[model samples]
Target: MILTRRAMLIGATTTLAGCDRIGSNARFREALFSAENFHKWAQRSLMTRDAMAREFRPDQISPIFRANGTANPNTPEYKALWRGDFADWRLRVDGLVTRPLSLSLAQLHSLPHREQITRHDCVEGWSAIGQWRGVPLKTILDGAGLRSQARYIVFHCADRMGTGRPYYESIDLTDAFHPQTLLAFALNDRPLSVANGAPLRLRVERQLGYKQAKYLMRIEAVQHLSGIGAGKGGYWEDHANYDWYAGI
Candidate 1:
């Protein structure tokens, strides 16, 4: 049964009597582990468990889409690189791995890739359809050679809040290896615009837009996001009360 925010908020007779209460409590615990500092443990339990985010047809692609999140991170490091057309950018893959990888966009693009048109639904209740082209996440993970204990895939990005660095987000192994989860380097059949995550982004089609983190800088194989930063698994999950597992 799905325990929506509506149902959880009302503390309906059924809600008060069951696991949502526990979930709420758990969410509180996960907040301190987050970098942006928000609570969301209960949010996951409130939603439908094991749900899927929406997908779409190729022709459903939107014509005039607005990119979400920071248009450009205001750091000298990012600026210098971006000004250079990200020629020095590399996607770092490390943590709980056999061999760490620091791969350039050219290197990543050389791998097998896929293109799919899918709908991106934001939490604020807007949606757009676009075609994404990139390597499937599984391909990268296979190359990374995840250790037996690695249970989550975390994305470290390049935008900031206040004085904090750009935040990171993560997902469990199930979603990480999903065939539809692509490291999107192109959107709408063209290279992703700066406002749209630039060089690369995540496309975990089974989850909400936030899970599809933009301006991706690194990918790490890990057993938990817990000790990483407050541990709730995402930026908004830590600061804004959004569920880390916003599945559909």
Candidate 2:
């Protein structure tokens, strides 16, 4: 019998609840991780690459968008940028591009941007709606001149996990160029707060909130995920066995 995406997500929820016990069994952990590949394949096969997530009107935006993950990165490097109001901050776009870019906050703001109100669904089973404004990731990719071989875009963020490793996430070029995918600099028409990924954050609307990497320091286009953390494509996925393909 075939399971729908909804069914799979429900199953994932149950699986996650027992994950601590599952992690204790090495064989069980390996089996679950192996199944993640099939899960990714099934999701991509069932949904079109460009299938849009539902968008809402401004009136639908949530009054208090709850901050997730790192509310405030206490690292010295991140603190310096926050202190200077990110004037010296630069978002480096490199790897598998003909023209690598190092865009400043001012330059990013000057670029063409798209604004939309969309729902953010978290793996923790919560949701919120917010207005996000930023350059469509495609615009940046185009400027960087993506090479034909480029397959995925990896977001390297400033926040570190408890283990002190930098946070990161990856999405395929299909999602990278999707209409709703953005490098958001503003939330609710205001400069992003430090608690909510100041400077810039990723908004891949079709995926879960964990995939929405925040406080981006670099964007790299690569053909493979092998060199990334644990070769699973994300920090949480590497450390906590979160599904690498976190589409909801």
Candidate 3:
């Protein structure tokens, strides 16, 4: 009874349509939120903090790793960086950190790197296995000297959604420090292309594809997500009612 994302979404749509009729019921809304929280709690309780997501062999990599979401930011600023081959681009790490950092692409490349071939399960019902290579996110966080008050790591991207809102996503400290959580710069041994989030992207392997924020411009350590877009922790979470914790 393993349901695919498409199947689950289909079932959820039907159920939600019914719920909409009673959407004004406070009890029902509370129950829905409670269920989402329970799902997250259950998963975290069952898995250890250091648990690793399943990885595949090089031979299992997808022949064509389809790029999801904004293919290219194509904005004036992003375009300028692209034109310069991203030499001037810097990933700013600030917010609730004792030592803020502005890391260049070259600096990131010089850090210790991790490579993994893992399946990216998109909520759109598509999955692709790709080999990602980059520095683990914990490495950057440590360098920034994350403040004790910080509870979540937010990724600010260069792309914007249809509504012109800047794309962003956030993860709790648990996932932020996970061994497989990487700020990936290369894929399949090649530097990422514009369509595939060149300068940098996130690889929170335990979560769905959308959690992998691309075109990362800034990484902010925040005490809470209340000030972020719609306060839902991500662009899709705010716009599409996507669960904040999209663990697979």
Which candidate achieves the best TM-score against the true structure?
Answer: 3
The per-candidate count of clashes, in order, stands at 14, 0, 0
The digit string of per-residue lDDT tens for model 1 on 1-248 reads 99999877877767666655665676654654363223234544554544444567766789877677777777787788788888899999999889899999999889999888888888778988888899998898888899999999999998785548567899888778777889999998889888898889999876678888988898988887887766778888777767776763
Off by over 4 Å in 2: 1-27
Q: Rate the local accuracy (lDDT) of all candidates.
A: 0.80, 0.92, 0.94
Question: How much does each candidate deviate from the true structure in C-alpha RMSD?
Answer: 8.3, 7.1, 5.8
TM-score of each: 0.78, 0.87, 0.91
lDDT of 2 by residue, 131-216 (tens): 99999999999999999999999999999988989999999988999999999999999999998899899999988999999999
Q: Is candidate 1 or candidate 3 better by lDDT?
A: 3
User: lDDT at 160 for candidate 1?
Assistant: 85
Worst 10 residues of 1 by lDDT: 32-41
Backbone clashes in model 2, listed as residue pairs: none
Model 1: CA > 4 A from native? 1-55
Evaluate model 2: give its lDDT: 0.92
On residues 1-248, what C-alpha lDDT tens digit does candidate 3 reach at each position?
A: 89999999999998998878777688876677677788899999999998999999989999999998999898999999999999989999999999999999999999999999999999888999999999999999999999999999999999998899999999999999999999999999999988888989999999999999999999999999999989999999899878888884
| Top-down lDDT ranking | 3, 2, 1
